[model samples]
Target: MNVLRAAIEVARFLEEQEVRYFMIGGLALQHWGEPRLTRDVDVTVLVDPEDLESFVDRVLERFSPRIADTKPFALRHRVLLIATDQGVPVDISLGIPGYEEEAFARAVWVKFPAGEKLRLVSPEDLIIHKCVAGRPRDAEDVESILIRQRLRVDLDTIRQWLEAFRPIIDTHDPLAFFEQALTRARRSLETGGDL
Candidate 1:
């Protein structure tokens, strides 16, 4: 499906539209963790609910909505599911106010193997994303990222964001979740275990 090309296309389109967005999910994990096959692309767009229809309309020019009623579905779920011309699935997550907006602002430009550069969320922010999702796979991704970028990643920033998101997202203890993941990753690295 040429996922890299698809990602470049989506990034270019969003940049042209002056949308503040960043790549996340599998693609972001690929950047920070061990590379894995990812079928879909995930992007977080800093779009307001009021402007959703216009935004969806613009995206429709190059991508087809996965559902019949894209606007309503997006509004309800805060995610617009669409597919590229080559049938590559893309999930456009509507950015929430605080955490997401901060993540987008912290996104850094990354040059892919294809020599196409696109914005990607910071490693700290990506960890927060995975921790929040809290699935087994997500935790594994977090562990991989930690093992790979151990010295460089900012644990404080990740902790800060997780702490902020705790009350906002109604998470009981984000820091605990992060600590557990970090501990596991550290143990894996110490024992020479493959992540």
Candidate 2:
């Protein structure tokens, strides 16, 4: 089967098992407004020890997940990488201590393949996440989404989030930086650059 179908099957399994997950990453941005191609599907789920064990069990049974225990010594949790039959990776985060609530609350539902419905992190949340993550790829992804979607993302909402999660961004003028990014994205769109 194709990657999309694989992801849908996984989502279906998750739903059937009553496990909650918030879809994040490139696919989610594409759904919002930006169009981009990404190989894997990334999901952030609320996971405790019991939830993690149950999820791992279900995923292994359903998809034959090949797990990698890659947690740091200081971290209390770990990430489970479940590779699909099509070789698409699904990164299931087992409980991020700080941002669990916001991640769940900001999820916006979108239609999946085969007429299935699933929740994805909002564009604003995606922006916040990428910025906080501070990875080069994340910046590029954010730029692509911002330009293509012309999201009209609520500046205040993003600003508030940054203010609340200041440590993550590691910058004092997050609002200004966010506005600058938005402006650059709009300019790129106006100039007909991959919008």
Candidate 3:
């Protein structure tokens, strides 16, 4: 199966097991920003800490881990690196209780190109995510999302969430990154140029 189809299949499996998840990373960028070539499907699943072990076992039954001792690694890092039978990568982030909780609560169902509905992180939540990541590419993604979403995207909402995440995510200044990206996006839009 192709990447998109494989991603849809993954989503279907998650839904069948009644797991709460929201598409993120590139797949989500396709919906809110410029479409980019992404090799893997990224998703964040909100599983309680108590059930994490069983949850890890559940997914392992379907997808092959890209690395050895994936369960241990995932338990340590809260990220599961696994792949489908077709060799398509699937990154499942074991979400924690803060921003992730809010992100999942805001997840919205959107129909995929194949006519299957998949829940995805909202544009505002995704913007917060990109900002927190604070990579050059992630900044580009934030700008693209802003440009594409325009006024429809809520800047204040982004700011509010970033402020809430600031105390926890101290590596990069998410609010600063967002402001810079937002400024650049507005400038690019005003100049009639694509970011």
Candidate 4:
């Protein structure tokens, strides 16, 4: 099955099991503009230990983890990564102090196949999270989304979030980096080049 269909099925499964989740990662850009193909699905949720255990169990029941990793190298948070059989990945992050409420508050409803509804983090939120993560791939993903969905993005929101996290990203200068990457992406797109 195609990844979107698999994503919808995962959302349906979460709903049936009463597992709350928000659509995160690159796929979320589609809500604001044209769809982009991502290798896997990324869902973030406020999962308590008990809830996480249950949620992970439910996911594993349907999509077995083909690959699992718990690397020693840590970034902002320690994460358990699981690659499922359906070409959908599930990254379960333990709660951080402030991100839960912010994510829920910022999330907007997105309708997928057959009018199925799921909450997705705003583009601004997605970009901010990726920027904060500071992984090369995350940065690239942010740039690609920004370029492809520039019209749909709320620049003010991105600016605000960037300002709020200025202290953390000061060294990386994510805002400046974002703008530069955006320029490059737009040029590439115009030239029919890949991001």
Candidate 5:
């Protein structure tokens, strides 16, 4: 299945319901960084913590859950895993206020060559998201973004968010990953994008 088409459908559904959301994960990476293959759709949806059940129920009307106990699982994990009618898997992150609110405000609508406007997380926000993910692939994405963006990204903002997330996610040092990626990205530029 086409990830963009499925993401577009899901995004449209969210818009119809007036639910605030933005495309994240690999798809957003493709817009800001290096193009890569990502099978599933990942989005951050702002839902009232008190209204999760109804929100999930509302989503169920348009999409089917990939898991058995989607509502309970989403409530516990803050992520709703489901699939579109065309069978493209999607992970809907239950976002709260504060940082997420800011990210939403910074989100941009990128008009593809075919005239499809896909809402994507900003480059700085995308870097933050990848840093939080902390996988090797995520590191590569960060590097590509840094190399492609150079001084365009808000490194200070990224650093600030990483510092705040530092205490919460002790298993992963988001700041360190960003720093390392920044270094490598610079080196790659120095070496003519060989890294």
Candidate 6:
């Protein structure tokens, strides 16, 4: 479905609309860690709930919403699922009130293998996202990123954010969970084992 091209097109559209956004999820993981097959493009758009409908309308001009009531769904869940004409899925996360603005501020531009430049979440921020998701596969992705990034990633920042999200997400002991996951990743990397 030409996911890369679709990503480039979506990025360009967001840029044209002057939306502060960044690529995340699978596309981002490829940048920070091991490359893997990712069928969809995930992005975070920094916009308020009030303005979400306008954003959705603009996006719908090009991408088809996967759900019938995309606007209300996005306002409720803070995510909009859509697909390109070619059927490549795009998951757009409506910027959460506090956390997303900071993530957008911390985003840096990265050039993709196909020569398209996209703003992306920092490795530390990406780690926090993976931790908060808390799926086994998500943890595995975090481990891969941890091993590849090593000390270059800012652990303290990631931990602080995770701590801040703990109460909000109802996660118990986020730091401990992160440490445990990181330890497992370290062991795997050290043993030259697959994640």
Best by lDDT: 5
User: What's model 6's lDDT at 136?
Assistant: 77
lDDT of 5: 0.89
- TM values, all candidates: 0.91, 0.77, 0.94, 0.67, 0.95, 0.91
Give the local distance difference test score of model 2. 0.69
Worst 10 residues of 4 by lDDT: 68-77
Q: List the residue pairs that clash in candidate 5.
A: none
- What ranges in model 5 sit over 4 Å off? none
Could you give me the TM-score of model 6 versus the true structure?
Answer: 0.91
Report the error of model 1 at residue 3, Å. Answer: 1.4
lDDT of 3 at 82: 94
> For model 6, how does the per-residue alpha-carbon lDDT over 1-195 read when each residue is reduced to its tens digit?
787888888899999999888899888898897779999999999876677789888888878999898878877888888998888999998887687777878899998778889998888888888888887787778888887776378878888899888887764566666898789877876788653
What digit string (tens of lDDT, one per residue) describes model 4 on residues 1-195? 365666676677767777667777656866643456777777776666545555555556676554543333212244546555566666655444475667677788887766767778877788777777777876677766766675367777776667677777656876766666667667767777643
- lDDT, model 1: 0.84
For candidate 6, what is the lDDT? 0.84
lDDT of 4 at 115: 79
- Per-residue alpha-carbon lDDT of candidate 1 for residues 56-137, written as tens digits (9 for 90 to 100): 8888876888989887898788898998878888999988787787787789999988888989988898899888777778
Look at candidate 3 and give me any clashing residue pairs: none
Clashing pairs in 1: none
The clash tally of candidate 5 reads 0
- How big is the positional error of residue 90 in model 5, measured in Å on the Cα after superposition? 0.6
Task: Write candidate 5's Cα lDDT for 1-195 as tens digits.
Answer: 999889999989999988889999878888888888999999999977777789999998789999998889998898999999999999999998999999999999988766788788999999999899899988989998888786488889999999999998877899999999999998888888842
Compose the digit string of candidate 2's lDDT tens values, residues 1-195: 355665676677778888777788766877865567777887777756555665666666666455444333113446667777777777766656556677677788888756877778888888887766756666677777687667577667777877777754554445555666777787887887774
Worst 10 residues of 5 by lDDT: 186-195
RMSD of each: 1.9, 3.5, 1.5, 4.8, 1.4, 2.0
